[model samples]
Target: RSGEAAHSGSSGELVRVQSGHGHFVHLVYDTTPAHVISELRPSVWVRADRPGIQFLVRVVFPHVANPRTGKPVTRLLAGSTYTQQGSWQQLRVDDLPKLVQAAVRPMRSQLGSHIDVREPYLDRLVLNLYAGAGTTRIAIDDLDLPSAVAVGNATEMAGRAAQKRGPAESPARRRVELAGNVLQVDGQPFFPRMVEYQGESLNFLKGLGFNVVRLSGAPSDALLEEAKRAEMWLVCPPPVLKDEPADDAQDRPMVFDARYEPVLAWHFGQGLTSRNLEAVRRWVEQVRRADEDAARPLVCDPADDLAQYCRTINFGGILMLHRYLLGTSFEMADFGTWLRTRPRLGLAGMPVWATIETQYSRELCEQISLLSSGRAPEPAASLEQLQLMVQAALAAGVRGLCFASRSPLDAQDPATRARAMMLALINIELHAIRSWIAVGNVTPEIKAANTEGVNPGITGGVLQAGHARLLLPLWTGTGAQYVPDQLAGNLITFVVPGAPEDNTVYEVTVGGLRSLDRKRSVGGMHVVDDEFGPTSLVLLTNGIAVSAMNSGLPGAGQRAAQIERDLTAYRLARVQEIDRQLARVA
Candidate 1:
């Protein structure tokens, strides 16, 4: 309102700011049959530099009051659309703050539950609004605005950034591939922790079929050694701190008070600071000089200030937008807008990985694939959807996809739940690999030589569909007494409790099951009823069931197995058509 122009409303004369090249759109709706609250959407274009692209959108909720009382009535406020930069230009030192100020005003008005904000940097603004039964209005401008990037502009920019860094040996020599798929770090077809120096885990990973391993946060020399020996690629982030940060349990800080936020840790800030760029650059160089693999490039999770870091360093792998772009949140569109600037971020075809913390990402990806293919969810991970997502990502020209962590499983009490989490990871990884292969472009062999299919367990059967998608809850102490025996196509559930901290192992026994006739010794299938406290379950896959039995719990053993067996049989029966085809053809 400070910068305004005169305008005439039906009631009287009112002052409204000149929208400039910005246009306004309004979305009006209500939660109830008769929505009483009202909202407006304003779109403004501001020229910005550096990160590039400019367009500020604000959803304004005005205070509608009674004229006689001369007091406020209903409060209205929600989210805002941030202003972006002009293609290839950085925001002027002066213009940056004005754009930021415009974006934050509405958010501040409805603080607390109604208004929520996340300010990653001085120039970045994020507003979230939870509106109840209300009316909303929206408007979008630039319906016919010219596209910003020229056909060959990004290619030229990428060339310039690369030339500035001079020449490097190669990115592969520094590579280290972890064993198996997600959580199974050790066991057959996968080694636990690979050390190129010791080279144990790397060798195991080579057999399992992983081309690349991420040493993002706090990787040890052992990890590096494994990579060297396995001949698999490694993607590591530059060390932000000498040691792990104080809040190492989770790098994400929790905000008890939404209105007033706290500062990020020193390491997070340093990773984005100009002072640290040189160190990061030097680290990359050192890795390259040490061995051929070092040049493979290091990946960085520039969580807060990506633009600041990318402007300086020649990062090998740049995580563009963490959870959002990966479909972890409801911000896929915003993520796409941001990703359009990847060529500007200075890493062209260098691997770009997706990271997300919640289940939303996988769920959302499934949704996207379904929408694209007009399919509805049957159950569990779908090969069809995975294929679609992988195809879409590859078409977008991304180098690779990297999931968030192995830690999520570690946090479990070596119980049933922990085992379940590990199995989930394995399921996810398997789906991912299968999806990648479906595309027929980016092969899993980038990390291995002969890749029929990637092994995701210590020793598990070659993955086939129609398996009951079971839940493996990382077992906490207070459950049943014995683990369930499993047969082919049975789902197993386990849990890791909370965070990936507990390093416990649970053993279960499966008696009446046989691996399919075509496979080797029901690969790595074991259920040992060891008296190791409460029986815990770990390293589970989609086709097995953990009978509900341990200690202080309810039903155990045979009964649970009966239920699981019934469920597995039902699922396989549904896939009988495919089974018949395989039998006849094979």
Candidate 2:
């Protein structure tokens, strides 16, 4: 709730807050450069009429406690630039700090010093409190910031200003790729929510030079049309999970049940309802008939419940799905073996993807490859398992290998999560990008082999038509911080701004790429040149950028834009190299 000051309100001298969803509040304030703000604690008092003391207040700021770093920032006091806390309990005057009491004193006591007036410019303050029944009071005894001054209604006013600032740009949307005749929507490699609003997503992507948007799940037809309209590519999957199970007489599991819920939720989340399934089937046919040249591929989920439905779901689209999660059990192995022996099942293609068992582990790499190859090694197998999977997938004449998220829920912040997801996507798509890198080079073939395998893979109908693809998802719900250190490789299924499961490729050229003084951004893919070597620049191509670039002289901003253009060209060259290698191997 907005920490506004109003006289004669209940819980006199205490900001009245309720308990429910969206219960958390935020406090925003300005600080002097020198004060070095730290631990701040605010007291929350309950109304005399309430059953018990109902509120606990604590300081909140943009900064978060860094456990890995040394001791947490300790400098703090009652009156800090920003302060917030959460609790279901109602607060009384005595429970609050002197600053809060003074601010609201007109409604209650008139005995103390007038509430310190925080500078209006510095007055932007917010007090975010989370309240609910049962557990009522929680207070922060300490925090850190500079020049503590509690301003009334300062938090809400500042929060509104911040909201107007809009969402932060994602790092994944920066790079541009000129794919053959068409451009790939190059922005954040893949985001789930983008599949729902494909048009706006693709337009946003294309506007920023993204070459492809991997259309996952059951995106609406309009979404696909938007991608096509934006001249972007899509990687689609079928909707087989929509069909009723063979045994309708059996009781269905709840949405939370791991066995059935994930798939059902995913299907439902994709907006695929029972009544609309037929309509979707027809649309799938239409997509196939209309754009044979750039039709998106149909990918599938490997969950057990979705097995037999693959055929029905595939709906004439290229079949792709992960192998590792399909199952690591002996029963799964036997079932896979039997299924492979079938003639009809053989008709469809299986593009394999490997996920890290944990974080970055050699065992994960090996196991992923092994599972992709069509062999079922021992469950809980390590790197050795990957080799077997890869071989099996290859033997089955599968399309190719996809590397998905490495650490899915690792990041706490939503923005940081978006960055991680983007990085992973970029890494996995290296094969595709490398293809374009090989173009225009005199000795392309030799370089290509060194990068992408001479042959990418073999598809049932068209070898290149249904080449292997990678899916990188930005997990939502993580707390996101606009940390510069994560901008580079933030594509690995991490987080994005507004789109819950989408990512935006950050433009590194335009913005002066900077990171936390001690930390480093994901540098796994940064190409360094000693002298005249590679450079990193953050780019922006939104309406603001276009307007700024066109009107401004060739000054600092223009130079940044130029750097963006140059860096994109350089990256594209590298990507072409990978593409050529895939073609060579293919």
Candidate 3:
């Protein structure tokens, strides 16, 4: 019977039924005009409002007219009896083969176990809701049976199929070494200033001073050769396999023993299926045989068992954790330290890499909306904010920095252009100081007496790279009720209270460098305004100081012009070097 269903009733009609033997109601859907069954999952929302009722829900797929005989045949799809009462339930019949087998028990012996059920034909989907002996009621509403291709499942199936196809040729393996927080390729210190871009123009990346390109999956052989010629390294993840269960026995428990603990952990933790584990095994073997020298590590998120498993297999890859800028400085520091101190589940220590997105945080995004009231608010990551995040990670001693986003690097849009410029500037500085930054150990907390009156938000640390020690002072504009103007001109001091009689100290700023006298103070202390603009300041006794000599320093007109000329010459030399490398590859 059709009527308005109670319990938050609406104008829509609902199927009302009384509990009795052979008392049933069904809705038939035709798949003749369009082959709807071939594309979409036929589903209906059912509600058993009355308690203490027993019902059997069966989805029937009647046979279509045989193309040769033009006769209608009987075909059973799926049937299930329900007793428990619940809220609105979604009954979806997507697994047609399994459902068909469960429905037709008598034909099981004749058709055998592996019958192909993908044939597209005119059929009828009949949803039968039957009530058992009891005083009960059922309502059916919101039936969304459509005729279209199942894009989601199709895409997944395609990906699984692709994983079965191995690379045509073996990849050449490269030697990768990690020594004390630094990664070296072929015995040379390799600082990965990477960019995630899909563009083919390596020239842009070269000009931006990036040394690595990170791809989601394996690159083509041609692309690999091109990257080799460009003097850049490629980082890619292993192919993901389908997730199939370890065993098909329904009676067995899902848990595994300690020997299978790693697999089980990976299966549940990383959401890997048995099929995926098999694929990973195959991919690892292929990498081991074909490209022993390549740094083809199986990249994964931070998980103990997963890390242990990879290490056990001698997979040399880094654990990349994203979404860094969302937390407070202390929280970030704690996370970084935790990552560094985690037990080495692998044979060798794995590098900890953190990702930074060049966009506003979710909270900030929502706040923008609330603050704007109705109008659209401008969303962005200020240059100062980006610098704060990168420095924090560096201070935490991350081996690699992974810049992530799908935003087009070559786009003409303003936001994209701004983000690209910010990345380039940051990378330029990193590329310049990578030698010092790569080897330096991060001193999480620096105890200096002179920094008492500095901005409370300002934090300082020292990076000890060899005999030279560089000071890193950072200020994240967090926990302040109001933005202080003085923050833009905050002063950071590095105090060495002992008599370093012969050591020379230089205050390095973005604009240029200036020398400091050792005898000026009791021992020696160098002070400089924490230039909170587009540049960073480092107090160092050694290494080349990076500066914007051409733009902002005073009394450096002639010096700035000379530096500009030198930069022009350097750019030209880089272009010529690229040409030379490309020619050699050709």
Candidate 4:
């Protein structure tokens, strides 16, 4: 919603607002800094048709910025107010300079009340009231701008202004950044084994091998503390105005909130849908002022691969891909086409990640019909199918991975642990070869072939990591096979061109990597052969990565005597912690 006011409209002086999700209404007097001779004492009568409607009076000056810190300056001078059960409540911010100064550094260049014309020359005062989910009718009277008047069609002007405005730019050199196509965290290559938090213990998730957790809404203090204790990163939502106020001594939105170290990135936007894309863009423009100097990158939600509308929407810098194909109605070639042209998307050296989960599955199109008929689903994806999907997303060239949201694959169902355990094991595998997987580039020179003729489904690709070549052979299963049957004992030969004969080759598998036997083809290509099953992972790396796996992985018969001695103690401590909880459901 634009807070830019139309000096006069057919609606006369009373500006009525109909606001909802992705919508806002406001009163504004857009003026040049020369005309800004202190009408900052903003007072307005706010009344909803219904009582108890929450309202806010934020004085927005879109073009305003602090001269000292180079941060955008927006005001919540008039704290928050409520419509008194259909009665009018006059909200006012008496000492505008005090509250505004308290919230931000003075934009007046020097101290005192003198306005500086040299720095960010604009004084467009906006009295904005945003909506929650549903629409609310708000009536405003007694527009109080001494130097100017409120625009009647402020909302209309805002929509247009937001359209003209490109997405906000975030400061560079974030905690998470990109080196080539690889994601670097604090100057180190980072492969985030991320899973959407689904009411699981933070310690449990950390122990299970997830380094990053996703939260749909703003996390609580306890949750942040727990994540810190668990030593995990978070993909979280931006803190809302409802939680923190401007008057609080210890709390400040722009500066203090920037210190949330556990937060890796902020996610916003309407996910895969485009109905509210414009409104979301507008909201981003206004909300970005609160996080002007914030460091972390912002990511959009459920980015639509079909429409790719999220590319047009502003999410700071980081944009995610949403082309999910391994599940129902998998299309290898069409999906691969998009992945291949990804680098040309002009991300400007920013790291790109993909949401590889059931949240954007084609099957949802049938059950929920969120997608078009062109994006169809037939056979369901099984566990083996999932394994191949992971291999494809990484091998096809995605930097990092965020696991499914509200997905059974991401869920840790106490009753059903097989799928969760398998995913955890896959995370373990991804972490092992992350050295190459994070920064490797896909090349057509590397190839894999089955001994028993060419298996159309079981194929592989080579990753050209610096000085090291990694090969991932996936049995993706061709034809109408949704979940293909296991093909065991068949030998697959992988050939990597232009590698030395004495390359230290290793095979990365679930939980660890093992040294593999390498042979040279008659044509002088590096070749490694291994027998694998349907769900088996065949990842071979040549001469770069070190083997971290112990050779002491015991067989089933010898495993009983080698179980961890602290298993029982750990279990007892866990049970005690559960019992000590405030609300024990049991």
**Residue 235, candidate 2: how far off, in angstroms?**
3.0
Clashes of 2: 145
TM-score of each: 0.28, 0.23, 0.50, 0.54
Task: Give the best candidate by lDDT.
Answer: 4
Candidate 4, after superposition: displacement of residue 560 in Å?
14
lDDT tens digits, residue span 1-586, model 4: 2222222332323334543111123456655332222454545556665433232335444333333223444443443345474666766545444455444443342223443222122244455544332245666555554444344443443344343334463322235654555666756677777887877777666645678988888788888878767778888777753334468865644442534667777666425455656655554554466655544566665433423433443344566666556444655433444555654544445456766653335455465444544433233344455555676677677777877755434243331243454455566556556766778877763445666656545566677666667676655445312445554545666666766676666654442445566678765454545665543444444422443222212111111111121233434664676676635555
The better-scoring model by lDDT among 2 and 3 is 3
lDDT of 1 by residue, 1-586 (tens): 1112112222211122221111122222221111111221222222222111223222222232222122222222222222332221121122332444444553354322333232212111221110111121111122111221222332333344344334452221111222212111111122121111112254433432234454434345556444445455554443332222355656532222211111010112222445566665555454434323222333555644455555433433334335433323333223322443554555444334443222234556567678868443322322222222322333333434543333332232323232222233233233323322222222111111012333211111111112211112111111111111121122231221221222223333221222211111222222322121111223222322222122101111222333334335545765785677679879
lDDT of 3 by residue, 485-557 (tens): 2344434444543323444555544335666433446435444444433234455553322232212232222
Q: Which 10-residue window of candidate 2 scores lowest in summed lDDT?
A: 441-450
Model with the higher TM-score, candidate 3 or 4? 4
**Which numbered prediction scores highest in TM-score against the true structure?**
4
Q: Give lDDT for model 3.
A: 0.48
In order of listing, the candidates' clash counts read: 94, 145, 8, 4
